[model samples]
Structures are given as structure tokens and as C-alpha cells.
Target: MPKCMIDGKEVEFTAGENLVKVAKRAGVEIPVFCYHPGLSVVAQCRMCYVEVEKMPKLQTACSTMATEGMVVKTNSENVKKGRAGTMEFLLLNHPLDCPICDKAGECDLQDNSYGYGSAYMRGSEERRTYVDVNMGPVIQKNMNRCIHCTRCIRFGDEIAGIHEMVAIKRGNDIDITTIDGKTLQTEYAGNYSDICPTGSLTLKDFRFKKRAWMLKKTTTVCEGCSKGCNMEIQHEGDVIYRCVPLENLDVNRYWMCDEGRFNYQHTQDPTRIIEPKVKAEGGWKTISWEDGILGIKEEIDGQKPTFLVGSDLTQEELTHIKEYIALQHPGATIQHFGTPGLTSTQQDGALDQILRMKSKTSNLNGAEKLGIAPLMNDTIKADTVVVMSAGRAKLPKINAKRVIAVGVYLEGDASQFDMILPGLAFSEKDGTIVNHQGIEQKLKRAVLPRGKCKSLSEVLMLLTNKKARVGANP
Candidate 1:
């Protein structure tokens, strides 16, 4: 490791590490706008001004690589003046809409301006503004808030492998918009909101939703696919507001696909079955947990029910299901099902060069590791069928006389089921899932189980209990 001095403090750095990274490691903060670790550094913002001992002028820390015996001053008078000038220029056209902006608390511009910007303005001319362009469903375009960091533009070309977003003009009049003002054509469009320094690009799903500081964050992995991109579930009062990518350099880096980013919406959907329900003559009727457990037992009590375990389930949940099936129904056919037509790990691979995976479920490899075979031809061959899922895997076709669904389900998903035992979503459960790379990650519980939802362990306990405590107050 090479050594450097940042603000009079000695610091160690690896070869080729930038000053912005090395300075931060030494507890010295260098403000930045266009210096996302995951993206290429352009030094376009010119905000990370640092004074090198021998250099004549201030240098942008993002593009300045640290070298042996290099001495960098981050908070000198000249550096502060340079950074303050840069901050003033950036805030020249940026609207004072922090109160209404979705990126208020988390905006890098807000934090940098308060720390480095001048309180008074010198320019008397009218501030430049542009008509907001439509960037399609995932992102809301607000050109008025852009500072031309070009993070979104680089992300599209380098990360998403799509050159959709582009800068049409140069200098202060530059505008970052999709090509021909077209709708975004990338499956990873949600990342545009994550990498943007300001509120220029914000998530449409999170617009006007909740204040960033008000929501609690839960670090978890995406169960949407086998990629297992790390993400944070932002929620308030047990209600999820949004999901954002958490940087894991090994797995998802700093980006997550729109499918994983907006996947939490299904958990909070209005028609999701939160309470235990039994299919009646007229329609579905709400039942207590005790009754729901007994109802499931009644359906497949003496029969060898075929257990269709979803590969989306966590290793803990799937292991429990396998053990429960073995004790409850010996010699019963049990198979794991996720994406239809994609059975084994051999069929699971990268959907794109990016983070998306072909296997829609998170634990396809884990299921295969547990000795559970994939459902053959996506078909079931039994009189009684029990389907267990965490609501990520596609539901397989069932031709059985009695069908029981035990997991999260929406109203439309219950049409062919005899009974529904509500279970926790990935956001409400703590368990482990193995990714496509064979790296195991833990899913942290962000909220309590919604309504009458119970864990698979609890449901299994009730079914296996010899002392039939039926109708005994849920």
C-alpha cells in the first residue's frame, strides 16, 4: 500500500485509488457530485477541489489519483474558495424546491451547498430553466433540477448497456434527456434515480410518497431473481414506500433493475391476501389462523399431497417445508418450481450482461442444493396439491381436486385455490437465500408480518401438532 497525506493526516492507499476514496478512508470528507464509485469519473462537476502541495491550482479529487508521498489539502483557504465558487455555479439554476423535491434529505447538492456554497448571490440575471421532459414510467424528468453531473448518461451507456440518455447541448445550457425525448427502453431504468446527484431524475413510484428521513430502512436482498441484488426497503409505519439499491460490489454493485426496485409494490398491493381466507360457495371468507391451519390439514390429511415448493422461498423456509412434508406425508412427491420451463440451475443464467437473471426466483440454486427436483414440465400429477411460495415464483398449473396455497397471494391469484394461508413477504421475513454465484445472503425483516400472515414454521407446527387445538382462539 502507498501512503499519502490528506489534510495533514497520514493515510494509506492502494495503487490507483483516487483521492476522493483515499481521503474518505482517512476521515477527511471531500465533497463530490459526479464521482459515483460505480461509474466512470469525468470530473465534470469540479466540486471536489483539493490543493496538492506542489500543484499550482486546486484539483478535483475524483479524477486525482493518489500517489506515494503525495500531500493533499482538502480544506485549505484556496480549496474552500474554489469549492464555494463551484457550488455557487451549480446552484445558479437549481430550483429552491427542496421542500417539495423527492431527493431533499438525500440530495448531494443540498449537503454540499450548505457546507460549501455562499449564502448570498451575486448574479442578478434570471435563472435558466427548461420544460420538464417525460422520461417514461420509472423516472420523472425535471431538467430544472439538473446540474449536468452526467451520472445518468454514463450509467445508461456503461452499466445498462443502453445509450438511451444523452446530453444534447454543451456548457450551462446542457440538458440530459432520453434520446428524441423517448420513453426509457432499459429494464434497469430504476437505477437512473439512484445515481443522480440531484432530483433531476427521481423515481415516479416514489414521487411525493414519503420524506426520506421519515422512513426506516431495512437492508435486504432482492428476491425477484437469483442475482440477489442488495437493497434497502424504505417504509413508514409498517407500510413500504420504496426500494433502493444498496451497493454490494460483488453482487449488484450500485444498480438494481426496475423489476427488483419496484417489486415491493406487490407486497403493499390493495388486493394482496393479508388475512387467512377459506374458499366458500359464494366467495372467499375470512377465517382465523386456527381455522386456516385446520382447513389446510383437512384437505390433505390422509392423502399423499404433492408439495410444489417455490424456489423463491428462503433456504430456511424450504428446508422446513421439506422436513414437514417428509414427516407429515411420507413418500409424497415434492418438487421446487420457479420460472416455468427453466427447471434446474443449468437453465438459470444471466438474462443480460447486467444484474438480471433468467431464473425469476432468488433461491433456485438453494432448492437444487437441498435435493429438491424441479417440477417436471411445470405440471402436477396428484389428487391433492399444496403450493408454497413467497410470491416471487410463477404459480404452476394444478389439476388436482384439492389445492391449498400457503404464502403471499393476491385476490386474482386465489381464483383456483381451495384455501389460502397468508404468509410473510420477503420484506417481513428474516432468512437466507443463495444467489446465482453461490454466495448466500440474508434477507432482513423490515416489517412485522402483515395482518394474519404466519411463518411457514408456525404453520407447520400447527399442522404437525398431535394435540388438535382446533377452533382454539387464534
Candidate 2:
């Protein structure tokens, strides 16, 4: 391996590794705006200017490739002056609304300005501003905060494969907007907010919500689909505010679709049933956990119930359910169901060239791996049916009169079920799920179980007249 000198430290380089990457390896910070690791290197920001030993002029570290015996000075006086000048120009038009901006704590522009910018302002003219256009439901556009970093434009072009965002004019008057001021068209539009250095682009779903630093982060995988894209659930006071993509080169890389990004809403939905309920003559009535367990046991006492297990459940939950059934009702018919028309892994393929999969549930592969058969024609023919899901899998058509649903359910779902045993959402429990690619990943608990919701293991134990054990590994 070849080595290069960066800020008086010798760092090994991988042939094509650039200065910014190499400098990072040596614990030296090289500030950048337009250089995202997943996106193309354009050096349009020129904020990473560094003094190369033999170079006549300062070079942008993002575009400069490191060679053997090459020396670079990242903290030189000339480098500091150059970076300060770049910061001055960037902050010239940027608004001083950091206190109200959603990107206040996490904005790269704010951090760079504080670290490398001049204390005094040079421009006396009125700051430039634009009449911000609506970017769509996923993103809020504020063209005034933009520093022409072009990260959002490049992301739409190179990563999302959509050339919707573009720069219309040249230089200082350049406007980064959709073609003809149109709304964003891609399904992965939330990522434009993620890669933007400034608050020029922000998530509409997360706007005016909790500040970035106030939210506690929990690293979890997306249950939106079988892609199992890694992400972080940001919550404060046990209330989830947003979901952002976590970098995992093997899975979703640096991006997640909008469906997955906003998927956390269902868990905290006001209409979601959080208490155990039993159907009476007039309507549904909330019941205690003990009564709910007794009701389930009495409902399936002598009947051979068909278990329609949802592929959205974790591998641990599925295994526990299978074991519980084998011990209690040995001959009960068990089947797995997820996306309609897509039963087996063979039918599960890429929905697009990007992260989405044909299987809408995260654990479709795990359910199949547990030796469970797919439900035929999306129909259950037994006299009694037990439908279990984590709310991601689509509900199947039931031919049975006696229906007991276990897991997250909405108020409208009450008509379809005779009894509902409230269970944890994916965010409220920690367990493993397998993607369509057979890669198993863990879903970390981000919040406590809603209301009287219990794990499937605990519910199953109570059904068998055994003491419920919480957090027991399958």
C-alpha cells in the first residue's frame, strides 16, 4: 500500500483514494459541501481547498487524488485564508434564520461558517432571495439558503436516475429548481433533503417538528419492504419525528425511498388500536390482557384454527409462534402471507433499479425460511382463523366467521376482526428480519409498546396458562 503525507501525518492510500478521504483517515477534517461519498465528485463548492506541496495553486481535496510521496498541508495559513474566503462567499446570501431553520444543529453550512468563516461581513448590498417553489409533499424548497453546492441536483441525476432538479442560470444568478418550476417527481425525494448542506431543502414531514439534537436516534432497518434498508428512527419523548437513511454499502447504500422514510407514521397513528379489544353485540369493547388471553383460548378451544402469519413479523416472533402452535395445537394449519400475488421468494424481485422489492413485507424470506407455506389465492377457508401481523403485510381474505387479529390494527380494521390482541409495532420491539436477498438484519426497539400491547411470546404464554416472560430470546 502506498502512503501520502497529510497535515504532517503519514496516511496509507488506496491508489484512487482522494485527499479528502485520505485526510479523514489521518483524523484531519477536510470540509466539503458538494462532495458526497455516494455522489460524483464535482468540486463545485471549492470549500476543501488545501496546499499541495508541489502545486502552484491550492487544490480542492475532493478532486485531488493522492499519489505516492505526495505531501499536503490542510492547516496551512494559505489554506485557512482560502477556506475563509469560500465560507464568506457562501454565507453572503445565506439567511440568518438558524434559530427557526429545521436544519440548525445539523447544517454543514453553519458548522463550516463557524469553523472557517470570517467574523466580519463584507457585503453591504441586499441579500439575494427567491420565491420558493413547492418541491412536493416530501421536501420543502427554500432557494435562498442554497450556496450552489449542487449536491441535490447531482443526487437527482446520478443516484435517483431522475434529472428533475437542474440549474437554470450560470454563476451567481444560478437557480437550482425543478424543470419549469415543477414539483419533484421521484419516489426517493426525501434524500434530496439528506444530501443538501443547507436548509435549502428539508423534509416536509419533519418540518417544524423536534430539533435535530433534541431527538434520540435508534438505528434500525426499514420494515417497509424486503430491501431492509438501514435507517435511524429519530424520536423525542417516545414520539417518532422522522426516519433517515443510515449508510450501509451492502444494503441501501446512502439512500432510502420515501415510502420507507415516512413509514414510521403508522406506528404512532392516532387511529391505531393500542388496547386489547373483543367484539360484543353492539360493537367492539376494550378488554384486559388476562381477559384477552382467556377469550383467545376459548375462541379456539375445540376448533382447528388456520394461522395466517404475516411475513412482516420478525424471525424470532415467527419461531415462537410456530413453537407455540406445535405445543398447543399440533395439527393447526399454518401459512404465511405478505404482498398480494407475490407469495414465494421466486416472485420477489426488484420493484425498480433502486432499493424497493416486489415483496412489500420485510420478513417474507424469513417466513419462508421457517418452512411456512404461502397462503393460496389470498384466502383462508377454515372455520376459525388467527391472523398475526406487524402491520406491514397486507391482510388476506378470510372465509371464516371467527376472526381474531393479533398485532397493530387501525380503527377501520375492527369491522374485519371479531377480537383484536394488540401487539408491538416493529419500532417497539427488537428482533431479526431477513430481506429478499437472504441477508438477516436486526430491528432495534425505538419506543415502548403502545398501551397494553405485548409481545407475541407473552401473549402465547398467557394463552397456554404459563407466566409471560418479557424479552425472552426465541
Candidate 2 lDDT tens digits, 23-114: 99999999999999998999988899999998999999999999999999999999999999999888888888899999999999999999
**On a 0 to 100 scale, what is the lDDT of residue 116 in model 2?**
93
- Compared with the true structure, what per-residue lDDT tens digits does model 1 show for residues 222-276? 9999999999999998899999999999999888999998899888787889888
C-alpha lDDT (0 to 100) for residue 94 of candidate 1: 79
- Candidate 1 wrongly placed segments (more than 4 Å): 408-411, 468-474
Candidate 2 regions with alpha-carbon error over 4 angstroms: 408-411, 466-474
Instruction: Quote model 2's TM-score.
Output: 0.97
Best by lDDT: 2
For every candidate in turn, the CA RMSD to the true structure comes to: 1.8, 2.1
TM-score of each: 0.97, 0.97
User: Cα lDDT of all candidates, in order?
Assistant: 0.88, 0.89
